[model samples]
Target: MTVSLYVPLASPVHRAPAGLKLGLLAALAVALFVVDRPEVVGAALVVVVAVGLLVARLPARSLWAQVRPVWPWLVLLLLFHGVFTDWRTGAVTTLRLLALVVAAAVVTSSTRVTELVAVVEWLARPLAVFGVRPARVGLVIAMTLRFIPLIAERAHRIREAQAARGAARMRWGILVPLLIQVLRLATTLGEALDARGADAPVTPPRRRAGASTS
Candidate 1:
């Protein structure tokens, strides 16, 4: 279906280590949450924009499209914050949130689910002593990331179909069908997973695993 929104490509960012990018994201999130200074937030916003442009290679137009959906709600929050708090504070917080969102979008757009899953498993491997199954966790994460965009695309298609079929507005008539279609897709995905033995219990890797591969 020509899914280009967040699919991984052979870009520079894709070549970077996923764990490092995740660490950067975590640091940025912590900074956003703890810092109350507007100047600091603004600086962080600049860093996010610069990184997205240079490292992530996100063009201005695509950046705009990524943030376009959340913009209206951001405006509403800006108004509320300004009235409830102060214009300057509201503006700063709103801008900080936007920067965080953009950073997240850039990371997801650049990183592949396979890379993300591998990172997850590698990170969690040491915790196996506590009975954690990193491979299973990685598989769950992979499936979630993989299907989320697919579900979104299907929903978009359903919405477009309803509109074409003379849906006046987003009434229950349109929403009910969309929900049903989403559920159907989810069921199909679940069935496919079952068929693939994805829900099976995870066992420890066999000793001499290279023997099988060889």
Candidate 2:
């Protein structure tokens, strides 16, 4: 089964406007970096957890699934900082990253794909002056989010196949087949998009010189 990042729920977080959620996320990211104190970051992390669990009402498993793949990297980050710098720095840095990741997972779980795409398209509207297609940009964002879980699923399947073949341990050899599969999928998707005229150029709206475009 293909696992989608967006969870279906009627919670307040889920009903919040996508743009508002994204804006708050951006603010949270900036605040976390600006305040380097571990206590502040820890407090922010607590708030994030409360929002996800209590406000969003998301199952802990859903949040864990998002964080599980990155725990190894987080461990490595802590070890690296602890070795060169200090344990306090390591703890703060690790917690900062963990908070960001979980916060992002919360946003994705609450927001629908279409809602996200619409927000992206709206944000990209100004770039249309430079011949950028907002719709295409939105499509790219949508595809990126959609593909993350799909690629992870494919890698899991490849690992299972390797294990079934009596491979004693996971090896780098899986990358070869995984790459091939990804390339094939991309080619098929591209062909389908072309058939649907997704590559067609969009015409920009005309604006009068005496009026404000905004």
Candidate 3:
């Protein structure tokens, strides 16, 4: 049942409206780019950490697991900035990236995929005049979000199997098989969608502009 990173914790963050959380994330991202000061970035990170620990009430281990996959990328970014640019800039950028990723993890951890899809659909409704079907867009976003964790799990399993076979250094070896598996999964999903009458679409219920705070 726990297909994604969502933790069923009863907290204010979990009860807060997803739309507002998303908006806050967006605002923080903009601030990160526009504000160049390390002090500001540090302050933002303090807030992020506070929310993650005190507000979300997530266990330290669970929070670490949620952000573990991105550590390499974060390190790479830090190293690149530190080498080519200045150490202060590198540190600030690293903090910015970490804050952004953690904010997203917090949102996804609290919100359900279906609720996120609905929120996205509500936002995308105006694009209907541009010939985009809101329902289809929502479905696409929902499936993409859902499959992300699934693919990550698959990749982990493949890596473990390769390690067990003494092919620990064969990182690239996982690529071809992973791609093929992803394609097969996509095909299966498409078939299942068709069977569910996705093509014979009816009007989707209009999503409320305001998200549920409960």
Global lDDT of each model? 0.78, 0.89, 0.83
TM-scores, one per candidate:
0.61, 0.67, 0.65
Candidate with maximal TM-score: 2
Estimate the Cα RMSD of every predicted model relative to the unseen true structure.
9.7, 10.6, 10.8
Q: Rank the candidates by lDDT, best first.
A: 2, 3, 1
Candidate 3 lDDT tens digits, 6-45: 7889999988888898998899899889988888988888
Model 3 / residue 138 / CA error / Å: 3.5
Worst 10 residues of 1 by lDDT: 205-214
- lDDT winner: 2
Candidates by TM-score, descending order: 2, 3, 1
lDDT, model 2, position 129: 95
Any runs in candidate 2 off by more than 4 Å, and if so which?
1-3, 136-214
Model 2 pairs whose backbones collide: none
Give model 2's TM-score versus the native structure: 0.67
* Range of the 10 consecutive residues with the lowest summed lDDT in candidate 2: 205-214
lDDT of each residue in 4-84, candidate 2, tens digit only: 699999999999999999999999999888888888889889999899999999999999899899999889989999999
